[model samples]
Target: MSAETPPGASFPESPDPDRTIEHRTPQPGQATANDAHTRQLPYGQAEELGFNAPDGTEGAPAKRGRGWLLAAISAIVVVILGGGGVWAFSQLSGGGTQPQEVLPGNAIAYVRLDLDPAANQKLALLTIARKFPGIKDSLSDDDPRKALFEAIKGDSPDLAKVDYAKDVEPWLGDRAGLAVLSSGAGKEPDVAAAVQVKDEAAARDGIAKLAPGDEYGLAFRDGYAILAKTQAAADGYAKAAPLSQNAQFSDDTSAVGEPGVMSFWMDLGELADMSGAAATAAPTALESIKDMRFAGALRFDGDYAELTGITRGGAANTLKGQPVKIAELPASTVGAISLSGLGDGFATQWPKIQQAAEATPDGQTITKSLEQFQQLYGISVPDDIVTLLGKSLTIALDQEGLDAQQPNVGAVLTTDPVKAQAVVTKLEALLAGSGTPLQLAKKPGDGQLVVASTQTYADKLGTKGTLGESESFKLAVPDADAANYAVYVDLDKLEPLYLSGLKGEEKSNVQVLRAIGLSGNYTDGTSMTLRVLFN
Candidate 1:
């Protein structure tokens, strides 16, 4: 049984402060001088009132009581409301004003690859997974494709939906496309249905010639049906598939490699295609993610911690420590999803139809590239790794006090023991008495380590680098670690580490790999790829 309900909800009225004040006593003997003075003071003494009197006005005490009451009520309201507001905000937003930190190392970016049955008859994607990084060298008899083939072919229905194409399109462009078949079909039907009907006279003739057996849907399987009966009702089915398999998937799937292969012999034209697509996608993707707030953080050693404070776009500094903590952070808006899910989200919405291939076909190549990207570079960037790449600290010997004994030294210098204690001796004699101040700065041959180029430079060096490339340079100066006075070596150091071939390869081998997952196979059948990122 239900109870009867009230028409409207009721709430208690706020207590009124003015109503709490009590009336005071009246003075004795009215109209006399003594009575007038007493009345003025405590509503009783006029001579003693002084400036406290309100021009001998009546009801002065009552006015004072009202003012105090109002003040008290206001204060109470402020405290109550302020505290409630803060508490309510915390409850609604999960507390705190700052977002959590995301470490790079903790993140596990995934690349999902779904093979097209018609494209490649291969029963599994193992033929393709063997070429990817980490997996290539690690694949064994127990799990030939590393975890990739199992990740795809395993009975785990949960993993089958992993989509690399969706997650990395924004950052890696069509590279994601080349790896996975994005889940959308082409704009128009690849095949259309058509039917043919025969007249009654024809049907009668065919009935007489009818023999042992006949199949009704054979033509329909191929695309259509033909009827040859006279005055007979006829029906047919027409089916359509994408003219180009690539069109069925998103752009990221287009750049993936073939099965059983690791790398591709990408020519200048192919590179141009990848680069152009990436260029167009980057700005759009960045804008989409600009408002994304992430939670989670990476912890680093003190030396690396200081580097995190350094802005991007500056010279690289060496950290004194051997290891730093990196955490993978997530945005509060969405609870944490797997690295694979993240990739799929991007592919499902990636844009770039303006430059689609005319008749692109899906193949084993795509599956391999997708697997490689996931095992190697990854999409689920952990917060810790990001921190490692984002921040760094410099260490050098501090010898300022030791140089005080020398002559005419204009300035003092400090040094860090970890980074360049050995180099400190060479400079001690020169700075002993001194021709100039012993300024600290970056040493030579140490430019390949800088991260957060643009932000770091803008904050510390008052300069910036190009966006297409993440540049790091040697800051050549007087000492091993100083903020002022440095030089850049773009061609000498940065280009070699980031843009050139492996440790021993020709300059012409400056081939680029799709960071999202697209990998290549050298002429020697060896898989090779490179990945770079910027915060």
Candidate 2:
């Protein structure tokens, strides 16, 4: 989240011409600006000022060379930085670089970012909340909103204390600080700012006019940033959301732009900074991306020392060595809003999570670590990573269950083997209709029941003959009753049952609930009877 330049903020002076190449990437799409704002959050009123979180792609410059081209450069940089050599790769290919070929089944990653320290801190505050379950009480006693204020105050201080041109760009991934660059302590607005321009000639002419920090507004809420299109087409987007009719067009002609243009196209360095930040932060956010199963791409074509391109063939050939590229694909944009104290957001609802984690092998250990991470960072655990953990436990149990004729999920527990087998026997009998609805799988651990049961549904839909592994709680009965149970079901295994009950388009409803359960419990002449609810 970059700083919002006050409307009509003065542009800073331009940089050296040679270092500053003329940017001519096209801006497509309507330049529609949203006036949306969130409800007054604990963070502050700044969030209510209607600055939507910019799409992650706002910073990736256009692609300019073959895939390996960037990777090849990074390799050289790594070597030079390690005191190997100072040679930088400058393999200039003809024309513009083509989009790297996307392979089938590859994942998409979208990255969203802002150079505004306040925004980062806003997110950081949320991250911090996850780590410290109760931070509101930790605020400075004098200031009611001291925590929020401190987070905002920490974005960037003393621009002169830092080299905006050098450190800021590298730090943020794009030259995000360019917007605040100063040629003199105080000076004229050197650059004109606008996002979209319809006039082909104005759009063409405008590219030649952009300075380093000049703002390029784009028209995306949250999606991939890598765009595949011609420069002219991309420029047409500026027309959709013009920076301003008052924006200076040419050094020679002060022509205004068309009215219908939008404001999505961002400055090259601005694009780079946002993209770079996203790239830099990706490793840390891997858990979230995996949980959401997100994927996407970003395009950049600026003088970024950090970004490198790698060719597909070149990348595959250099397998023994570190691949020429770092990570290929656009930054993901699934920004997670902190939900620490929404009455019953996560704090109250997590007992079920606690119970589930405790029942599995070392579930408490992993969950505790997750809690610690959140407390420290105020961020949520990525669902994909959590799912992975869940699946690992499931697989371990399933493998154990399969070892015997009519396997019991708990028999695999090596700890307290006696109790484990006893629970397994009880569970198997219940599942096979020979015992009670609830049966212990093992002794209670930590404050959770290590139990299992075979419950049925109304013809239990969604057994696509595949019986995908899906699980959830079986609606808890209040007042500390053992009847409050959670259940796991392989959706792939249950798809056929769900399909049998559905007719035509109704089958699609099951698709959304593919990984979850149904609304109620009903008896099916199958091995189990249980309840399925979205919650």
Candidate 3:
């Protein structure tokens, strides 16, 4: 059976299938031939009755009542004929294609595209382009959508005359989707795409005009048109389970946002296996990752255009309830990051790491390098180095020297004061002849050791005000106590310092980065969120 016709059925063809037919219904205000009072009676009565047609056609036939009934029946027949014609045309055009009919059962990834927001997305792009006077001037002749089409067509004269909105949009239904099927080991995957179109025949004709080569195999089923890399692949897709019907895929994509302009889903584990990495054992921390899905939306506000994405994964349970250290730095700090419960987490995952490392050639080399470093520093790799590193670490940048050019950047290791001091002393001695810039000192009345880029910052540490008291820091980290990991960047303070050194286009390109703050917090080990705020 032909792919255009469904099983056990066939559609008759029409010559003028593209022609549009309008069926108009009689309105209440209009005089109908069936109304008795509307008949041409006496002169005064006929004028008062308003029985004449709007265009002053001849009065109803002299036969009266019976003739009026026939006219009404004739109008009804015309209406039915018009409706049937449209359906017949659609069927002849192969308008019943569906995505499931063209996708393979074992597809690895699926992407769905919704062009409903195409106009809005185009407008947003134009608005962003208008930010640069030169670019805006270049796009002056054509609207954004037409301009984009021309750009894509480039030097192809044939594609320039194609009217996408008229010839393509009607046949393309609400959404278009694609599925990828793995061919086999060491071979490229097969790709199949399905689109819902209003006029299947028109879409097919357009496709033929645009690309007449045998590079793509085409089939139509239901109200969709399916395209595949090969005829066999397209035929197989017609019999396979669609990506939407796959239970695992459905479950994996549950967290993804719906009805967006664009959405994507991928089987991460399957992709890893395809790439040959699955041959090696993965770390326990990454064992739970099965798939990744993301959905994005575009928004324009005045001069800025923002794209936001929400992503979720299958590994939430594996990383739940992890604790993070909260750092207490000085108010003058420009950047800071803190992580808590590292020692315990590292201890649990270290064996798996060692095994995976030893199994690989690169890992073996790293092990040898670590052993050499331990011997050179006269410190045990795990007992002295790892033990002295403690459960949490905080790194921060703060003002220290006489000039802004010499900002103080340092790391605070929360460990036994005596052991941390000893490790610092050994590290400093090892770097004595290398001219590595570092100064280590013990924080007063605490078991923390500070390592700074300058001695002045090391001495001033824990003596000045704390970051917790700063308004910007407080705003960035509202729930500081609850977070197991936190990152904060004071863009307000760094913007001018960085911008002052740039000129012209280089400066304008980065102007969007100014007055923007970024912060992220990982809580409960299972969930992490980052936010970018514009001021």
The top-ranked prediction according to TM-score is 3
Native RMSD of candidate 2 (Å): 25.0
Candidate numbers sorted by lDDT from highest down: 3, 2, 1
Candidate 1 lowest-lDDT run of ten: 85-94
lDDT at position 270, candidate 3: 65
Candidate 3 local lDDT, 1-535, one digit each (tens): 0011122332234344452221112121111112333222111111110001111112222112122222322322221111110001111111223354445557777665443322223233333443443233343222222222233334444455557676544454644567766666446666777766678788778665555343667776666667776667666666667666776565554433222234456666666556555556464533555554433332332233233334445455322223333436677777778776665556555776777778787987988988898877787656565555576677877644425666777777776767877777887787874787455545633766777767667665545447767665554554565666677777666765677898885566455432222223332113233433223
Which of the two candidates, 1 or 3, achieves a greater lDDT against the reference? Answer: 3
What's the true lDDT of residue 148 in model 3? 25
Of 1 and 2, the candidate ahead on lDDT is: 2
For 367-450, candidate 1 gives per-residue lDDT tens digits of: 456457445543322322222222223211111222234311111112122223233333443465366535333222222121
The digit string of per-residue lDDT tens for model 2 on 128-188 reads: 2222212322222121111111221233232223332332222111101011111222232
Off by over 4 Å in 2: 1-392, 395-411, 414-438, 441-492, 506-535
Q: What is the lDDT of residue 160 in candidate 1?
A: 39
C-alpha lDDT of residue 485 in model 3? 69
Q: What TM-score quantifies how close candidate 3 is to the native fold?
A: 0.60
Model 1, residue 210: what's the lDDT? Answer: 25
